[model samples]
Every structure is written in C-alpha cells, then in structure tokens.
Target: MPDWNLVGKQHVLAAIAECDRLGSRDFLQRYRFGRARASTVWHRGQEYDSKAILGVAYLHATGRAATADDFTRGEAGAVDLLQGLGFDVVVDEEALAAEKAPRVRKTTATKPARASRSAPAAKPRRTTAKSDERVKVCPTCYMALPATGICDNCD
Candidate 1:
C-alpha cells in the first residue's frame, strides 16, 4: 500500500536508464521480475518490461522493493499510471500473440521400407510418444499424432 503518487517521471526515467545500463535480462534478474508477457515500455528504440520499470521506479522513489503480487498489470494498472506519469507504455502485441499461439511440436514423417519374402517379415516399429519431442497429444482425442497442431483424427 505504498504511495504510487510519490513515483514521479524522473524516478521512472532513472529506472529506464538503469535498465539500459544493465541490459534487460540482468536488470530483471537483479530486480526479481519475471519476463513481461503483456506490456512493455519503449525508450530510444529499446523495449523494456513495463512492470519491471515501474517496480524499480517505486524502489527509486520509496526505497522499498515491490513484489509482483503488490500491484496488477494491463491498461488499468501500470500502463495507465505510466502514461499519466508521461512515459510511453505499450500493449506489447508481439508478446500477447506469442502467449496466445498454440505450442505444437513439428514432426517429420518417416516411411517404412517394404519387406521381402526372402527375409523374415519386419516387425512393426514401436513409437515412443513420451520420448519423442516431435510428437504431440491431441487435446480433443488422447491419440498422438504428428505435431502439425491440427489433430487429424478430430479434424
């Protein structure tokens, strides 16, 4: 319940400057922030996790490290406050799309070789779906299929 009103434009700018000096990964790690999933801040053509910047800005203003659960995100939270504080905050469409996109593994099809009468009939190859990264289980049906994402059985 610390005051967000105390956080000024200078504090946010300072946080952004510090993030630039340390790089995003190191900065986020140092501040204990997870990767930004929905929103970001743009400064000098560089993208920054908006929530991280605000959290650190709160630190700069109040000398207290705010945890993730302390405040919410999205338009009604950091985005609105940052915009009011005169900083550029964006929706991060790329990140949103990536989160929404289905994660289907890409599988390659292998053709079976023909067996000859002169040789013993070849045993059917057993596929271990659990170990194969290229195989994916269809949510609709419990069957494993090529990672095409679309379950051919259901589709």
Candidate 2:
C-alpha cells in the first residue's frame, strides 16, 4: 500500500518479484534512495552511485551491466517510486551488521624465540639526529655517506 514513485516499470516488477520470493513486503525497502540525494542509496558499506545502481539492476536482470548506461534518470525515478511501494529493501545496514558478526578461531601459542623468528626482522634501528655526526667514513676517500645509507659521490 506504499506509494511507489521514481523507479523503472521493469525494475518495479522485479523488486516486486524479489519481495515475493523473499516472503517480505520489506524486500524492496532495502533499496531506498534519500530525498535530498536522489542519486544515491546504500549498498554494502558505501553509497552506491546512481550508475552503480543501474549496474546492479542490469546484473540482476541480465546477469551483467551490459546496458547499465542506458538506465535513464526517469528509470531511477521509477525505482524510487517502486521503493515507496513498501518493498523491504535492505539499505546496506543489514549487510554491514552481518559483516560485523563475531568470528571465533583457535589461538596459537609459540615460544618467545619461535615467535620472534617468525616476526619480520625489526627494521634496522634508526639512529637519532645526534648520531648523524658519527657517520662511518668511506674507506677509500674518507668522504662521509649521507644518512641515505649510501655515498652518492663515491659509489
């Protein structure tokens, strides 16, 4: 009984079918667009660009986004209208919730020496600014190597 508005005619039909298959009038609700930003809707953790929505619709309808660019603003408007029809669109919130679920696993116990060996070797400890004065002199010409770890003028 909701007021369907901006979506495409075919998109409306598909959302309706999805709603029926999912056994929830709210299925289409998962695809709500904001009043202020008609071009965006939630998808996973990000805002799905309007183009992506068409891409999604294309994928849903034809297994690919072959003609996604063909989805016009009017079509997007039609989709908005269909959402107004009481479809239970998920709006990315559920998707994010599912991702945040706690996962359990076994903990590893390693000897300090073994763990240290597995750990990446600590990067050579950086010397402080005070240490710059103590740079190693080149054996050939006594020229100092800039902290660059190399003597550019020498080799």
**Candidate closest to the true structure, highest TM-score:** 1
- Candidate 2, residues 38-125, lDDT tens digits: the string is 3434333433333334333433443322222243433344344335543323334443345346658789997567644476678888
TM-score of each: 0.57, 0.24
Q: How many clashes show up per model?
A: 0, 26
RMSD of 1: 18.9
Q: Can you tell me which runs of candidate 1 are displaced by over 4 Å?
A: 73-76, 92-155
Q: Relative to the unseen true structure, what is the Cα RMSD of model 2?
A: 24.3
Tens-digit lDDT track of model 1 for 22-111: 788987876678877788888888888877888778877765655565564432377777888877777866766675576899999986
Best by lDDT: 1
In model 1, residue pairs whose N, Cα or C atoms come closer than 3 Å (at least 3 residues apart or on different chains), thus clashing, are: none
12: Cα error in model 1, Å = 0.4
